[model samples]
Target: MAALRPCTLLLPVAALLFFCAAGFAVRFPDPPGAWLLSLAAVAAIAAPPLAALLRLFGPARWLAALALLSAFAFAVESLGVATGWPYGRFYYGEGLGPLLGGLVPYLLPVSYVPLVVGAVAAARHPRSRPLWTLRSAALLTLIDGVLDPGAALLGFWVWPGGGPYYGVPASNYLGWLLSGAVSSAVLVLLWPRGSPAPPALLDGTLLALAFWTGVAAFGGLALPAALGVALLAAFLARRAGIRGCARVTFLKKN
Candidate 1:
C-alpha cells in the first residue's frame, strides 16, 4: 500500500469512488448507509483536485477553481432549498436523523465528482464533436430537472420538503449545467497537456447511481442538451478567435 501511494496520487479520486460505490451497495437499503457511503464517494472524486490544489496552495488558479466549484455547489444546493427546482423530485427526510442541520446533508454534493469528471472527459474525448458540445450544455441544464427526484425514488439522494415543483423539481440538472460549463471552463483555463483518460471515479459513481438511482430515470434528454452546449461552445470559441475551437479532435499528434 505504501509503495502504491505515489502512484495513487494522480487519480486518488477514482480510487475513492470505486470503494464508495461498493460500500453503497453493501448496506443497499438504509438511507444512513447511503448517505455516509455517498460522502465517501465525494471524497473519492474530490481527492485528486484537492491534492493538486493543495500543492499549488498559493496559485490563483487553484483557489479560483475551488471557489468556483464551491460556489456552483452552493448555488445549486441553496436554490434547491428555496425554489424546489432542479436535481430531481425526491426530498430529504429530516436531515440524517437530526445529526445534520435539517438542511441538505453536506455529503450529497460530493456526488458531483463523477458528473464534473464527465464534463472533463467530454472536453477531451476524440468523439467529442461540436454537435454534442452545445447540445450537451442544454441537456445538462435540464438533467437535474428530472434526475434529482427521480434518483430519490431509488433511494439514491434527496432534497428536503420533497417538492413536485413545475412537475419536475430537484437540484440535479442545475448541477449538470454548472458542471458542464464550469468544469469545462476551468479545464480550458488550465489548459492541461494530453488527453485525459476518463476517471474511474466517474465510472464508479455512474454505476452506483445506476444501481441505486437508476440512470435511465431521465432518458436521453440530458445527453443531447449537453451535446448542443458543447457545439455552441465550439462555435463561440471560434468567434472569439480561439483556434480549433470548432474542432473536437485535432488531427495533429498528441
Candidate 2:
C-alpha cells in the first residue's frame, strides 16, 4: 500500500516526460538525444497501463496478454514488409531501438500493445461485443492519424510515393483498420469478465490524444489535429453515455 503511492505518482510524471520528449522529437528533425528520450518516453507511456494490468490480471495473465499482442503486431508488420498489401510501400527509418530478423523493430510492441489495451479498456459497449470491438478499432485508427503524420515529418518512416495525409498513404490507414479490428476483437473476447479496466488505461489514452493533437496543431498539421479533437470528443461522450446507462440499470435494480 505504501509503495503504491510513489508508483501511482510516477504515472503523471512519466506521461509529462513523454510529452516533452515526443514534442522535442517531432518539432526538430532528429534532434540530438531525442531518439533515446523518445524510447524512454514510450516505456513511460506504457508503464501505467502495464502496472494496472499486472495488478488486475496477475503476472501470468498480463504476460500472456502482452505476448499475444506482440505476436499479432509482429506478424502483421512482417506481412506488410513482405507483401506491401497493407500500409503501402514503406520502410522504417533509424533510431527505433532494434529490428527483428532485421525487419520490424523489436520494440514494435511498445508502440502497439498499450494502445490496444487502453482503447479496449476505454471502450464502452456492454451488450454488443461487435460494437465494442468496432469502437475500439476506430479509436486506434483515429489515433494513428495523429501519430503517423508527425512521424512522417520526423523521418521515422518513409512512404515512398506518398499519396495523402501528409506523406502517409491511404493504404496505411486501411492496414491499421484491419489490424486494429482483429487485435481489438481478440483482446476484447479474451478479457476477463467482471474485471473493470483500470483508470490508468484511460489516462494513457487521454495523454496520447492530447499530446498528439497538440503537437499536430503546433506543427501545422491541421487535418490530423482536427480529427484527433473530434474523435476524442466523440469518444468521451460515448463513454459518458455508457456510464450513465450503467448507473440507470443499477438504480433500477435497486
Candidate 3:
C-alpha cells in the first residue's frame, strides 16, 4: 500500500500532462521536450492499472496476460502495417517512439493493454463473460473512434488513402472491433472468476478518453470530441451507480 501511494497520486497528474501536451501539439507546432513528456506521461498513466492487475490477478497471471496481449497486438499491428487488411493501409510516423522490429511501436503493449483492462473494468456486464467481452470491445472501438482521428491529426500515424473522418478510414474502426474482441477475450479468459473490477482500474481508459477528448476538441473535430464526452459521461454515471448500490448494501447490512 505504501509503495502504491505515489502511483495513485501520479495517475491524474500524468493524465493532465498528456492532455495538455496533446492539445498543445494539435493547436501549435511541436514544443520542446514533447516526445520526452509523452513517453513519461504514457509510462505514468499505464502504471496504475498495471499495478492493479498484478494486485488482483497475481504477478504470474498478470505477466501472462501482458505477454499474450502484447504479442497479439504486435502481430496484428505488424500484419495491418504489412497487408492493410484489418486497419486499412496505415504507417506509423516518428512521433510514437521506437518501432518493434521496425514494424510497430515498442510501446504498443504499454499503451494498449491497460485500455483493455480498463474496458473490462468499465463494461456493464459482470456475471456474463460473453456480454462483457462484447461490451468491452465496443468500448474499445468507441475509444478508437475518438483516438484515431486525433492521433492521425497529430501525425502519430498516417493513412495514405485518407477517408472522411479526419483522414481515418472506416476500415480502421473495423480493425479495432476485431482487435478489441480478441483482446477482451484474452482478458476474460484469464480473469479470476468473481473478481470485481475496481474503480481505480478504470484510470487508464479515463485518461485516454480525457486526453483524446481534449485533443479532438482542440483539433476542431466535433464528432470525436462529442463521443469522448459521451463515453466519459457514461463511465462516470456507471461508476456512480455502482457506488450508490454499494452504499445502499452497506447501510442495509449495518
Candidate 4:
C-alpha cells in the first residue's frame, strides 16, 4: 500500500462504521431514521473507492473516466426514470439527497464509479479485450445481485409488483448486464497507459463487498449475502495467489 494519509484511510473506515450502523438500524421493525442511515451508508461506502481509483489512475485519465461514467450514468438513469427501459420501472423513495434537475441524484456517479473501476481492475485480461470486458460486466452484475435485493427490502426504491429473486425482476439483471458491459467497454477504451497499483490493495472494492454482504445478511437476505461473501473470499484467494507467484519470480530473478 502507498503512504496514504490518515485522513484518506478514514474515508473507508468511516464508510464501514456507517454501514454497520445502518445494518443494525435496518434490522429493526420500523426503525427510526432508517432512511438517513441508509443514505449515509451508501455515500460513505462510495468515497474511498472513488478516491483510491483517482489515485491509481492519476487525475488525467481518472477525470476522463469519471466524466464519461458520470454522464453516461446520469443520462441512462434519466432515461430509465422517464421511459423505464433498463433497470425496470422504479422510483426513488427517500434519503438519496437532492436530484439533478429533479431527474437523477446529483451523486449518482458516487454510487456507480467505484463498482465500475473495481470490476475493471479485477478482470483486466491483457490478451483478450472481449474476455476482459465480459469479466468486468459479470463482476459488476454480481455486485448488483448483492446490492439491489437489500435496497429493495429497505425500500430504497420500489419495484411495484416485484419479481423473482427477492422482488428484483430478472429484467433488472439483464439491464445491469447491458449497462455493465457498455460501461466496461468505455473504461477499457480509456484505460491509462501506465501500470496502476495492484488491484488487491488499490481501493475499496473489498470493503464495498463486505458492506454489501453484511447489509444483506442483517436484512435477512441469505442467498445474496452468501454469494457476496463467496466472491470476496475468491478475490482474496486470487490476490494471495498472485502475490505468491510474484515472490517466486522475484527469487528466481535475484
lDDT digits (tens) for residues 84-160 of candidate 4: 87988887655565677776777678778877877887777877778889999998899899888877776666788
The per-model lDDT (C-alpha) reads 0.43, 0.71, 0.80, 0.70
Cα lDDT of model 2 by residue, 167-247, tens digit: 888899999999999999887877777776655555456556666766676678999889878866664554444332221
At residue 113, candidate 2 shows an lDDT of 84
Q: Give residue 60's lDDT in candidate 4 (0 to 100).
A: 92
lDDT by residue (tens digit), candidate 3, 134-205: 999989999999999998888888999999888899999899999999999999989999877766577777
Clashing pairs in 3: none
lDDT of 3 at 190: 92
lDDT of 1 by residue, 1-254 (tens): 22332222423343344434434443354555555544554564455434433333336665676666656665655565556555444445532332234445555435553454444443343444443444445534543443443354444445444544423443455546645665455544453344343233133223333332222222323443344334334422322342222211111233
* Cα TM-score of candidate 4: 0.80
Clashing pairs in 4: none
In candidate 3, residue 176 scores what lDDT?
A: 94
Could you tally the backbone clashes for each prediction?
36, 0, 0, 0
Off by over 4 Å in 1: 1-28, 31-34, 48-60, 85-90, 94-102, 125-150, 156-179, 190-254
Ranking by lDDT: 3, 2, 4, 1
Better of 2 and 4 by lDDT: 2
State residue 127's C-alpha deviation in candidate 4, in Å: 1.4
Lowest lDDT 10-residue stretch of candidate 2: 244-253
Best by TM-score: 3
